[model samples]
Target: MKVFDIIIQAMLSLRSNLLRSWLTTMGVAVGVFSIIAVMTALQAIDRSVAAGLSSLGANTFEIQKYPAAFFGGHGRNRFINRPDITYEEGLAFKRLMQEEARNIGLKVSRSGNQATYRNRSTNPDVVMVGADENFTAANGFDIQQGRNLVEQDILYARNVILIGHEVYTTLFPQRSDPTEQLLRINDDVYRIIGILARKGAAFGQSQDNLVVIPITRYRAHIDSRQSVGITVEASSRSTYSSTLDQAVGAMRTARGLTIRQENDFELRTNESLVESFRDFRQTISIGAFIISFMALVTAGVGIMNIMLVSVTERTREIGIRKSIGAPGATILQQFLLEALFLSLTGGAIGIMAGTGAGNLIAIAFNLPPILPWLWIGIAIAVCSAIGISFGIFPAYKAASLDPVDALRAR
Candidate 1:
């Protein structure tokens, strides 16, 4: 038989048992959905992490009391008991690295606070950060209106704040310029000295739901026990490693660490952050792949059972065709095509549904939509392979049946 005729015959056979065919296809659909949905979501997350980390600008690193992330295992106690990087130590390190660094920024942050302007108030999801003049340049935040906090503001502990785009829009819904206005944080009323240009989102959270105050004021008015985090900008990319070394040595000296004592603080850069995320993403991807593989294997078994039943029911038809000069190869081809069609149909539907679901999640998290075409293509290929692998035995049985016996029995 011609290829097209075989395909048409295969499709007709499936259509004749529409309900059974659909149920069988559903198994494959679910399997494909599991693989595609998670892979799509992970692709979007990878894209978001890359974009977010790059937003911190180039040739920069931070020193803090704890690592940016911790993978649970041994040595948790050491990090837990490490001393906080004090404000005094931060300044002394700043003074020590003045000539070696291009720009040094100090910041401390507290989250889950409300900011009120007049009768309008933001949800308690607002984040309050204390920073100096270098914060804008070091962190790559641009002032949309008014000016960033100057050194004098931090030195004198001014009661002024810079609002992020989300905070500004939420508090001043009318789009009015918020500069020179007063906003209340706790019992303290602060002047809105500037509005930050929209910086978008990072890792599913808004980067713009924050308020910035001077570091000195943050120490004076807010919790003083929290460690200060310091950002150090290398003079150039080539010197970044050297600058990090200088920062480590300077921080050790400022904190009075001996040569034998291991450094208590953690230092991280954009490169390290990206590497950490890559490892995290890989671990999650492997887990998802394993789960999806199991589902697909289950679906393959279902396809095999359904195809075997199809062969049994069509034995007389196969006998009649073989009796009329039909080749065993043609019989095998017909059954194989039927199975392939079922799997591909399910796979096509699953791809559409999975992509839509993944994109919906991405939208909810405010991440850019990412279509993993490579994965989609691979899914379809896998579906085809599964169909051929599961259908071959049944197709071979149908093709090898004795024509007289099959005809006589049925």
Candidate 2:
């Protein structure tokens, strides 16, 4: 028989047992869906991490008490035991690196503080930061309105504050000028000096829910023991590497670390942050791959069993065809094609369902939808391989059947 005739016959056979065909395809679909959905979500997160580095301004690095991230959630106690980078030490480091760096910012932060403007209030999740004049230049914040914190603000420990876009919007919904307005953070009142530009959400949390005041005032009114984190910006991208190297030495000198002693403080940069996230993504991908492998293997076994049953049910038809001019090769070809068609159909459905489900995460986090083209291609190829691998034995059995015995079985 011609290949076209065999294909037509195979499709007709599947249609004859539509319910069984659909059920059998479901297993393959589920297997495909598991992998595709997980990969899609991971890829979306990967893109988000890269974009979120805008929080760390270009050519900027931070020196703090601990590393930016601790992968696998281990060794937290060991890092916490290290000494804090005191306010005195931060000032010394900034003075030491004054000539080498373009901008240097010192900060300490307290979260879960509410801001009140008249009777209006924000949720108790505002982050109040103690920052110096260089905070804007070093931390990627632009002044949307009013003047930014000047050197005098830090020199005298002024009560002047800079409110983020979200805080301003929450307190005054009418878009009125927030400068000179009294905004209360918990019990203390501060005069709003500037409004920071809007910075959208990162990791599902709004970056704009913030307030900044002079570091000295923060130390006086808030937690005095809190460690200071320092942000440093190079003059240009070309000077970033040299500045980063010099800043470490300057920090070590400021902390009075000898050549034999190990540095206690952590240094962080945008590149370092990306590397940390990459490790996290790899772990998740490995887990998804293992799960997908197991599911696909189970589904493949089910396909083989179903194909074997199909061949047995069609024995008489096979015998009748063999009794005439139909070749065994044609019977084998038809059975294989049927399995291939079934697998491909399931894969198609799975791809669409998985993509839609994964994109839901993007929508929730206000991130752009991502399509994993490489994974889709791999899914198609794997499905084809599974169809051929599992269908072989059943197709061979049907092709090798004895026409005389098959015809007499009824």
Q: Number of the top candidate by TM-score?
A: 1
Where does candidate 2 have its weakest 10-residue lDDT segment? 69-78
Q: Which stretches of candidate 2 lie over 4 Å from their true place?
A: 1-12, 15-19, 72-74, 201-205, 324-330, 363-366
C-alpha RMSD by candidate, in order: 1.9, 2.6
True-vs-predicted CA distance for residue 86, candidate 2, Å: 1.4
**Which pairs clash in model 1?**
none
The digit string of per-residue lDDT tens for model 1 on 159-214 reads: 99999999999988899988899999878999999999999888777899999999
lDDT per model, in order? 0.88, 0.89
lDDT of 1: 0.88
Q: Model 2 reaches what TM-score against the true structure?
A: 0.90
